[model samples]
Target: MQRDKAYVIKHYKKSLDWINNLRGLSEEQWRTPIAPGKWSVAEVIGHLPPWDMFVLNHRIPFLLTDERLPKGPDVAHLNTMAAKKSREQAMEETLNDFISTRRQLLQTIQQWTNEQWQHSFKIGQSEMTIIDYFVGLINHDLHHFSQIQNVIHV
Candidate 1:
């Protein structure tokens, strides 16, 4: 029932690959400067956690909780905080959180229908559907994935 199963799965596979590639790196490798003054792989991983967790745990479920967007724009701040930690700590907790939440996000996507993908709902300032948010998530990942590769010199 996924509207575009091929498209979804393709991106899903690509995302999974990018995540896995990071996981395969050693702790030092993860913290290596991936870009000039951007963020290391560990920080990038830390940055990804909320994309899934906030969407699943707060935003979607809290459709009635409040109009406030969940896990809004504080991620850069969070990444800054996580970056302060040693690579070991960031990878263990922050990176793992991304893996956990992404697992949940993929699981959630499995239950969606094509129509459900774009079903509009009100949130904060504008009306958008789950699909819009999910698309944002995908794009965010891709954009950062590029940054990660650049930083890691991979």
Candidate 2:
């Protein structure tokens, strides 16, 4: 909630810890939908890695510079593919992907200078500080984490 680098890093690490500990979930539970017509738990978790990779590869490099940030991903298409893969793959694989990618993201965040964290940059028509950008992402993670918690009753 502080929206500082420390806070953002904490939640990112927390999310990884939460996912790593989910090995206890039954396969049926992993495959169960969070709600009717919504993504299954696995799908929800599976979608995270690509977004993390996007931040690592796309957003971070441009956020402190004047360069135009790359266009955001096609959400529907990416989620569709992620969901399909989640439904097809084992839960361990999905969780491992998340862990690996998220760890990379965390490492990158940890290396940022304070100015990099506080610097403002444009994304399309809008501008926000790098810390603010990460706060938004942390909120996104919280929303999905909450959805999964409700579905799995964990």
Candidate 3:
């Protein structure tokens, strides 16, 4: 699926607003699991900033270049750590972390040229455009957001 840079940027910006608004949720609600045997809303949101940082620090620099990309994060380990931190920290801390990292990501995205958006790059064995990469991330955000919404009705 083709994704416009503007659309992706919009989603990034909207995500900040969405998470910011979640400040109003009760502490219990913030900690509520999306489903049985699943992550709480805080865990889900907390996991996102590291991935954004990964994209900003690792993926973005190497994309559209001949350099071999660095290894991706260990997802399970990272998620586990983020979840543990989320469970231990205040809701405000989690929300602030999400907003800060997402804002950094959005700022980086705003500076990309059209060529950067559409040019194909090899990420490991898979080749895709910057837009394509972001579309996948956006879908991920949507999925987690839906889960959060379902549990909290916010």
How far does residue 150 in candidate 1 sit from its true spot (Å)? 2.0
| lDDT, residue 88, model 1 | 48
* Residue-wise C-alpha lDDT for candidate 3, range 15-56, written one tens digit per residue: 999998899999889888999999999999989888888998
* Candidates sorted on TM-score, descending: 2, 3, 1
Order the candidates by lDDT, highest first — what do you get? 3, 2, 1
TM-score of 2: 0.97
Candidate 1 accuracy as lDDT: 0.66
Steric clashes per prediction? 3, 0, 0
User: What does the lDDT read for residue 139 in candidate 2?
Assistant: 85
Query: How would you encode candidate 1's per-residue C-alpha lDDT over 44-83 as one tens digit per residue?
Result: 6776665566677777665433355654657666666656
| CA-only RMSD, every prediction | 3.7, 0.9, 1.2
The local lDDT score (0 to 100) that residue 146 gets in candidate 2 is: 95
- lDDT per residue as tens, model 2, 1-154: 3678889889988988999878999999998899999889999999989889989999888887888889988999988998889889999999999999999999989999877899998877788899989998988999999999998988
Better TM-score candidate (1, 2): 2
Once fitted onto the true fold, the runs of candidate 1 whose alpha carbons sit more than 4 angstroms away are 1-6, 62-76, 82-95
